[model samples]
Target: MSNFLPTLQQNSSNNFQGDENNLQKTIKPQRGFKWNSKQPQKQQHPAISSLNTPTHNNSSNSSNKDIIDFNYTPSHQLPYLNNRNFNNNSNVPKLAQVSSHKDLKKLVETTLNSDSVLEQAIKLPKGENINEWFAVHTVDFYNHINMLYGCVTEFCSYDTCPKMIATNEYEYLWNINGVPKSVSAPDYVKYLMQWCQKIFDNEKIFPTDSNVPFPSNFEKNYIKPMLKRLFRVYAHIYCHHFNEIYEMNLQVLLNTSFRHFCCFTKYFKLLSNDDYGPLLELVNELS
Candidate 1:
């Protein structure tokens, strides 16, 4: 596992910057704005309807447009831990004992291959309450970003990443609660993390139990926008900071985590085509 880890990491780093010019050409600068205040009349897309696996009949009460059809299976296969000289019955190491990157890597390899672990990781509750699922994944993605960016904080600064946009030109703006602000990349990411943290920390909106109702317009107003902004962080990392990630020898981890995230969001249609278009090349290669 250790021997293959370095090789996989190296391969991911080598291909991480594939066809930058092509990516730049395809990327349309995202606009800064809030969602429409009024909900659009409910319209159903066959593709969306086919994918939905709702646990409740909230569709009769809420706008069908707001409900995502999450019934479709993911087309892409996630990367798996290579099993060698492994027994299924072997006891897996506890997370608290993982004290180093090497230990963490081993833990990941072991856990990912375990059927019990994979089932838990991939399973989502059947319901109209997408907030629970969204909240869980949101925290998961934030942890990934924290690890990936935290590794190279010294290199991630205003002088290095002057603007939040991946391209050198100022084509994109950071929109916070409907207001656009142009700032350094580090600052933009900082605010983005803060916003996500605030949402995750709030118990009223993201309750621990399944019985609680999410605030009205929560999915349309907050969850969707949060996902869009999160994709920007991914864009910035893949476009600008991949080399730094390579230097830190964390490419494989980043690649695997990012691929999982892409597949998860894609399954739910959480990201728009324009939002993920820039990174599609990399995403395809990783898949």
Candidate 2:
């Protein structure tokens, strides 16, 4: 395992509150948001009937969409040799859109597809701005996990997953306004993705102009929170949707994206040891 895989400290009680026991299946019939009823159903946990399709309409307009509508096509799936530097995802800033950021993205993409992940994880191109490196990867990971969840939305319904727990041991309670509340898996993930997208969209937080420098607190304030929450989404997918992903033949995609995420976050130290706790075993395995 990489040196970064050391077991992390648990979250302080006040910061995150949850009973560290197995997720208890409630007897109440799943009563909230349901996916498309017409879609095929899958075997599910007791008391949670498998439900319908995604809640949001799949439309062309990508505005105020609870889950961002933008889609990401991984470079590996493309004719990478012919199109290595042609990233068209507008949601992520090409801090190098008119310059060298495209090259950086291609370099990172190559590293993701390369065998020596640990060695390449810490590399920053000579004379590259570390903030720009973090910015691009941050948005890319968001697009990736968001797209992956969209794939499993049919399975990850409010009724199926009543509470946002990776397992019985690690439950994620979202702090709505101020209070920590247990919400449905889809809703919690929706809120989480939207929040991260909002941050990523803010020019003040992530400037697109080359002359402007990112704020000093960018790493501590923005990168840390975005990635820590992103990891939770990854944890949920691994815990709840791995079988579905494997059946879909997207397991390699998920695992590769996750490993790339681990590489960037661990190398940059954006997330602390405690933040990796939920998926520590997977981190070790994937490492």
Top candidate when judged by TM-score against the true structure: 2
TM-score of each: 0.59, 0.63
TM-score of 1: 0.59
- Separately for all candidates shown, the number of backbone clashes (residues 3 or more apart, or on different chains) is 8, 6
Candidate 2, residue 107: CA error in Å?
15
| Model 2 misplaced regions, further than 4 Å | 1-113
| Clash pairs for candidate 1 | 51-69, 51-70, 51-71, 51-72, 52-69, 52-70, 52-71, 55-127
Error of 2 at 235 (Å): 0.2
Candidate 1 lDDT by residue in tens digits, 1-287 = 00111111000001011222322111101110111112112222222122111111223422322222111112111211221112342522322355456665565555433446545455564432456556556656665665566655666678977777644432346554455657787777676665555554444555433445667766776677777777777767766766554444445566657766766677677776556545655554443
Local distance difference test scores for all models: 0.49, 0.56
Residues 180-236 of candidate 2 have per-residue lDDT tens digits of 777888877877765665565455666645556789988877777778887888878
Worst lDDT run of 10 residues, candidate 1, spans 6-15
**Cα lDDT over the full model 2:** 0.56
